[model samples]
Structure formats: structure tokens, C-alpha cells
Target chain A: MDRVTGHGADRSSGRRPVLTAARVAGLVGAAAYAGLLASTRPFTVEADVVTAVALVAAASAVVVRLAGDRSVPDGIGWRPYLPWLVMAAAVVAWELACFFGGARPSHPTLSSIYDIVARSEAAKAAVVLAWVGLGWALVRT
Target chain B: MTWRSVTFVVWTVLGLATLVVVALAMAGRGRIARPSALLFPVSTHPVVRVLVVLGWMWVGWHFFAR
Candidate 1:
């Protein structure tokens, strides 16, 4: 017996069947932007400029989503999401504790660890690309 | 272990826990809610969806910008 569960019943999986020309072009453009941002030094004006561009992209996703159907969804229940809420709360709590306790080398915040890992140009570019990709996903969702 | 080491360990554990949840969800485990299930309804609310993306923006700035 086949059981069809979850949303989008017509679709077997959420993934796109084929990458369109527009998507390929977008990926190429994002990669170029990531490389350009990777070359900039952190804490410099150049890095700030790159960050601003990324933020704008994220903001654009918000605009695009809002421009669509504005109807309130049915049954936005908290029960199903309790586990995720708890996990998010735990992470936030620990981050706050570490932050207030002093972000020493031994007691590093997540961002502090990210800073160390993102020091490499390749890693930095990858992170920027990931952030851009996440924004793109947000737009699509 | 020192308090600092403990802090680092706790953070690592939290990160790992998140990864585990994502992996389980992706594997289509019946016990776990998929990422789409967790986030799709979030996009339904106009205000909440905007706030979520704004939070994402803040994280990028915090890590990558001055």
C-alpha cells in the first residue's frame, strides 16, 4: 500500500526536475559575487559593502514573498512545533550565557568560531555563497 | 574541565544536536518533522516571515560585516 503523506500531494519530492536557464545564470552570478566578497578583508569597508548587498538580497526575498498571497494560513498550531521551539530556545540560552560570561578563546560564541573558520578565502567564499543560496531558497519558498 | 571548556563543549553539543535533527528530518523519519513542515507555515504569516528573513540578514551581517 502506498501512503501519500505531507503537503504538495501532487509532487513526489520538493526538488526541481530540471535547472532552468535562469537558475543556472543565477548560480553563476552568485558565485561571482561570492568570489568578489571573499577577496575583501573582514572589518573593512569592502566587506561591509558586500554584507550590505547580501542583506539587500535577503530583503528582496521578503518583498517577493509578501507580494504573493497575503491570506492567513489555517491551523498554525504550536503543538507540532514544540520540539523545534525548545531546541531554538536552548541554543539561544547557551549563546546568551557564553556571551555574558565573556567570549574568551576557551568560551567562544558560535560567531567567534565561525570567524576562525571563515578566515580562509575559500571558506569565506563558500559561506557567502551559502548565505546567498539560503536567501534564494527563502525567495522560492 | 574549566568553565570555558564546558561552555565550548555545550555549544558544540547544541550545534551537533541541530545537525542531527536536520539529518533525521531529511531522511524522512516518521518521528521527525521535515524542514519544510517546520518552515512553510511560517511563510504564511506576513509579519513573521519578514521577521525571519530579517533575522537571517542580521546573522550574515554579524558574521561577515564589521
Candidate 2:
């Protein structure tokens, strides 16, 4: 558990000031990419292009992870993951229930609520960027 | 009132509860592990890692494209 969780280490220790030129350029580039994606209509060629990029990136991540260090600690049972599993299950259950209940305005599923937020291009771009960043984080693990 | 409204309320509560749990974990509260702490080890397994990344890709496509 300690090996996996770093139970004794300072959790806040990793963060550092990374405001270099390359970091700034990377942030700006991501924002520009997200903005460009958001400008296109959904299901269109432009949209599909960005989506393809994400797909390719994720596929590469999987391949890299598989080809790299594959070691994992033994005997790390399911108990440690129970909290996340339960939370995810609860969220998904309600999403399904709401969808089955007709997904009307009165009973908005999470996606429906997100639809309203994503109506704003800026918000849509932010979410797109966040989704990409989250994928990278998960893949690096 | 209606079942729809009640369902919406429950969904809101679930969202809020999840947020609370994440907040607690971020704060380093006892018995609540950080999400990174949990996810890092799980992702070490190649199959689960692939599934998770694929799920993430699906989400991006579902919301942003199709």
C-alpha cells in the first residue's frame, strides 16, 4: 500500500514553478487547439479531425504503457479502489436512470446539463482541453 | 412533486456528494485517499489502463464530436 499510495511522503512536494517559455508555449498551443476544435460544428470534418487527434494520442499512450515498464505490486486488493468504484457506480446509475426517465428538461441527466454549459464555445473549449489533459494524466500513470 | 423532479434532485445530491468526497480526499483527510493515489496503481495494469484511456477517448468524442 505504501509503495502504491506514497503514504508517508509529502503529497504537495511534487508541484514546482514551471513557467518556462516552453511551458507557456505548450499551454497556449493547447488552448489554440481547443479553440479551433470548438469553432467547428459537431460531427463535421473539422470536428472529426480534432477527435481523431485525441484518438491517436490515446492509442499511442496505450501502446507506450504496454511497451514500457509493466510491473505492478502484488496483492493490491480491490478494497483500496472501492471508494472510487462506488462513487462512479452511483453517478452512472443516476445518469442511466435519468436517461430512461426520458431525459426531459425537468429530469436532466449530467450530459444534458453539460449540453447547456457546452453551448458556450469558451466553456466547450475548456472542457475539451480538460478532457485531453485528464487523458494524458491517466495514461502516464 | 413529480418523479422527474425527485430524480433530478437525487442526481444533484449524488454529484454534490462525489464532489465532497473528492474535496475530502484532496484535503488529506483520514480514511479518504486521493484520487491520484488510487488511480496510479490501477493504471499500472495494462488492460485496465487501455480500457480507461479508451473510455476517456469515447467521452471526448461523445461530447465534442458525435
Candidate 3:
């Protein structure tokens, strides 16, 4: 009798898959976020945005892998860090938009954005989608 | 019950559900095995991999970095 593994691989050969650090990190992050969602206050706009992004990122990753496109690059060198740079840029842009654009308070922190978006369902949904898309991109490359 | 109380109850349930799922994944048992198996590929993807890192960073940034 042969034991079948989740990836459709045969495990009867007696070789167990080794869990890598990256995989551990992903699992821990997902678990932590889910925990946060459950233990936090009424869903703040910022929390919602982050949740939406995580779901979208997870979904997109599933789709891409299922598509069977092996041509995707392996993120050589500094490519992996690009998303951090993008996030930093987004933070700066948020600050500038809040200050100069006058659409929000002088300091546009997560709390400020949450206060503004929490009240409006449409605004909240839109911001969630936009942030999720950015987050998806952040993960993609 | 007030909305806050209702939310608290709801979240408590959700938190339990999340804990169960995490536990299953950690143990690699039951129906979650397949999905847990897929996590390796998903995490390894160049793009998705970055999100994992960023997600952890986001947690720190939001909760501690202020």
C-alpha cells in the first residue's frame, strides 16, 4: 500500500518533506493575522485593508501556481526587496497627500486613514481593493 | 446585547476557528493536508514570497512601530 501526499506525490518511499524557514514564516504570518482579526476591536479600516490584501495575495498566488507557468522568474538579487521600497514610497505618498492635498489631517497615519474610511462603506471597499492590489503586486515581485 | 458585545462574541468564535485551522496545519493532518501542501509552492513563488515577509513586517509596523 502506497501513501499519497497532498501534492499528489508518493510518500511510501519514506522521505518526509522538510519544512523550510520561508514556509514556517508564511504559516506563522497567516496564523498571526487571523488571530489579530479575531482579537481586535471592531474592524478598523486599516485592519480590513490588510485582511483584504492577505486574502487577495493568497488567492492570486494559488491562481498563478495553478496556471502552470514556470517561466516566472525566481526573483534574483534585490528583486525580493522591491516591495519594501514600494511600501515605503506608499507611506511617504500617504503623508504628503494628507499634508499638502488637504484631503486628510496633516499626519496621515494608519489611524487617520482608518478614521476617515471606517464610516463609509463605499470608501472602505475601494480603499481595501486598492491596497490589496498593491499588496498583491508587492508579493508578486 | 450591544454591538460591541456582539462583535466580541463573533470574533471569539472566529478566533477559535482560526486556532483550529492553524493547529491542523501545524500538525499536517486531516483535510487541511492538501492546502497545507500547497503552501510550500505558494510561499516559494518569488512574488508571493515577498508578501509573506511584508505581512510579518506589516504586523510589526502596525502594532509596534506606530
Candidate 2 segments exceeding 4 Å error: A1-3, A6-17, A20-22, A72-74, B2-4, B27-30
TM-score versus the correct structure, for each prediction: 0.83, 0.84, 0.31
Worst 10 residues of 1 chain A by lDDT: A1-10
Which whole-number lDDT from 0 to 100 does residue B28 have in model 1? 51
- Model 3 chain B: lowest-lDDT 10 consecutive positions: B30-39
Q: B1-66, model 1: which lDDT tens digit per residue?
A: 887779878987887998877776566544456666766655667777787788778878887776
Fraction of the true interface contacts (Cα pairs closer than 8 Å across chains) found in each model: 0.43, 0.44, 0.07
Relative to the true structure, candidate 3 reaches a TM of 0.31
lDDT of 1 by residue, A15-103 (tens): 67578998889999999999998888878999899889878877876787688766766655565456577789999888787778764
Instruction: Write the residue-wise lDDT of candidate 3 on A38-138 in tens digits.
Output: 34334476655555556556556646654665665433233323333444465555455445644333334455546555466455444444444444444
Best by lDDT: 2
Q: What is the TM-score, restricted to chain A, for candidate 3?
A: 0.34
The A-chain TM-scores of all the candidates are 0.78, 0.79, 0.34
lDDT of 2 at B50: 76
Q: What are the chain B TM-scores of all models? A: 0.69, 0.73, 0.66
Poorly placed runs, candidate 1 (over 4 Å): A1-16, B27-31
lDDT agreement with native, every candidate: 0.74, 0.76, 0.48
Model 2, B3-23: lDDT tens digits are: 767976897788798888788
> Regarding DockQ, does 2 or 3 come out ahead?
2
Tens digits of per-residue lDDT for model 2, A1-141: 354443455666676777988788878977887898888778798898888887897798679768876576455656545677789899888788778867368678777887888889999899888887787678776
